[model samples]
Target: MALPFARVVFLCRWGAKRWGIATAEARRGITFKLEEKTAHNSLALFRDDTGVKYGLVGLEPTKLAVNAERFLEWAVVLADTAVTSGRHYWEVTVQRSQQFRIGVADVDVSRDSCIGADDRSWVFTYAQRKWHTMSANEKAPIEGIGQPEKVGPLLEYEAHRLSLVDVSRLALVHTLQTDFRGPVVPAFALWDGELLTHLGLEVPEGL
Candidate 1:
């Protein structure tokens, strides 16, 4: 049987700042539709399955500039391990490489069937109740002006601090090719598989 999961989607804005992170508005949900026949036919219908699969409560961006290697190392460590009830609950780690402009790592939930799906499309839900209990601490780093002499140190610091929490998935929302530069912000969420019944962002009325 497929384990129950919740998906959380965040609407983000990119500013001219060299670096920063922003959190989504509370009580609002990101929605997507499973228009693809393959995805629709495979799962039960009549349900709004495509939404934020994970519960996204907040977002954090770091200002320190660092190389890709160091940035990933810290991110993996932060996501893989968690401190719960003054004790360690599970061990999470990055199982892949830092080759992509945006990097990702998984927090192993002990059950092979726990987290379903590949890519950033799906993720396992963790600390559901705790997520609600914890208040949002949305923090974005200070923006960099012009190009810094070096981004290595800044990136390294950001990666280190980022590693202290539990994030289900990370997304490189905008890239150089996409006409976005500096402060490559990534968004993370706590996913439950059930949210993907819908997909994509909604258009404003009378678009």
Candidate 2:
């Protein structure tokens, strides 16, 4: 269900034009960090020179207590920063993962629910060697592009655009256009691996 490459290009161009450029402050970017306090307690957080990593090893869902703050079914976390406006870009490095989801979500997305399973979030998911763009439990297969080791998610708030970029190739993978209900934060979920996040990166040229 991937759009033709030509159409993807046209839509991206239109979005860039419609939103224009972000403020100088936004262009500089800010350091991205995951909020451990808000994350599922079963998941562990580690920091290194590259960035922060969320480790999912030894996580047992069956042992988890029934709590409103924890994501019961999936290991999920959010960034401490929220995007209200302007353009933002961040990179996620996937390692030792069988299945993972990277995306943004409303600040109020329910912790008991998995991301991309409701109206409050959107995600680019990789599972079983297949890739899909998901929202509201609906998934669209992203054809042609092979699985990427790293992904860059670019958010243009005013333009209502969320684009996934193949970091190594610097190519657009997919884009979602929708009006956001409120401020959103970078969201992540994993079934069997860790994710390293890089922030403060300037939006790549022509993407």
**Which model scores highest in lDDT?**
2
Q: Any idea how many clashes model 2 has?
A: 0
- Cα RMSD, each candidate: 20.3, 10.9
lDDT of candidate 2 over 1-207, digit per residue (tens): 111111111111112222223343664774556765446644666773333344534345445444344454457777766777888888888887768888888866776578898989988888989989898999998875676678899988889889899888888888987559877778887766678888678889998
Q: What tens digits encode model 1's per-residue C-alpha lDDT throughout 114-173?
A: 122222112122231211111122212222222111111001112221212222222211
Compared with the true structure, the alpha-carbon lDDT of candidate 1 equals 0.20
- TM-scores across all candidates? 0.17, 0.78
lDDT of 2: 0.70
Q: Locate the minimum summed-lDDT window of 10 residues in model 1.
A: 147-156
